[model samples]
Target: MRARSTVLAACAAAVALLPAGCGGGEKADDAGASASPGAASAAPGPIPAIKPADVKPLVGRWVGTAKDYFQFTADGSGVWVRGGQRLWSGTAIPEGGGKYRFSWQGGDLKTASYWGVSLTEKNTKLLFAGTNQTYTKAVAHKGKGKG
Candidate 1:
């Protein structure tokens, strides 16, 4: 209870620092009218099925905030890095229809973790369990006019 109170107080303090109710209220409708308070939110769209080709595009280096790195190889092998150190290495198996079952030996989730496909963003997939966060693909830059 004490920890909860402290966290709530911190959140309240943080919210107070922001302007006017922490950016809530007065959501606009599709017809350019204000939505009612406590109105039902829009439903999320369906997750698309992933293909082997989709997984192929993700076979590269990906970098996220705080030195988080994700790498996938063509030969069903991959690596995860944090703070310039190897965090996890495992094999990725395709379960058909754009989903992958990640299997790691000694890591966060030992058994397996389900991954879904994002058609809009080809490089990254949604982590369904443990934590919900998007892992972004790392972009490589080349010198101008130098192959």
Candidate 2:
């Protein structure tokens, strides 16, 4: 009898807590419920693609604010450095349109998408669509030649 009573109590408690455990309130509209004003709730818009030949210009050091930068090589590998420390080393493979798939090295093997390289005589910019970050090409510093 005691065992049966304990079982009944447990079942009652579970039933009482079920509603709270789930999102058991009034249903909210799909659009307005979760999204804040002026915020994007859906995926971002498509980025413009560039030809494969255009990717050649991307092979160089690009710098961002706070010492964050990326160094890409002709072989398609690159490294992401932030605050003078190497954070992620990966391969930026051109995906045939302006997009490049940045595949990080390691067990996790995370990947990011980058596109939109705008180049001018004085400046070059690479846009990372995921975070909406833009990195400018870093000009090589010239040293004084031996006199």
lDDT of 1 by residue, 1-147 (tens): 775565445434432332232122112123432221122232212223334464686577765444455677776456655566554455455555545554422111222332222212543553322223355676687778956
Score residue 63 of candidate 2 by CA lDDT: 77
**For every candidate structure, what is the RMSD over all alpha carbons to the true structure, in angstroms?**
17.6, 20.4
Show pairs that collide, candidate 1.
Answer: 50-97, 50-98
Relative to the true structure, how large is the alpha-carbon lDDT of every model? 0.43, 0.48
**Residue 67 error, candidate 1, Å:** 1.8
Which candidate number has the best TM-score? 2
Q: Which parts of model 2 are misplaced by more than 4 Å?
A: 1-55, 106-123, 144-147
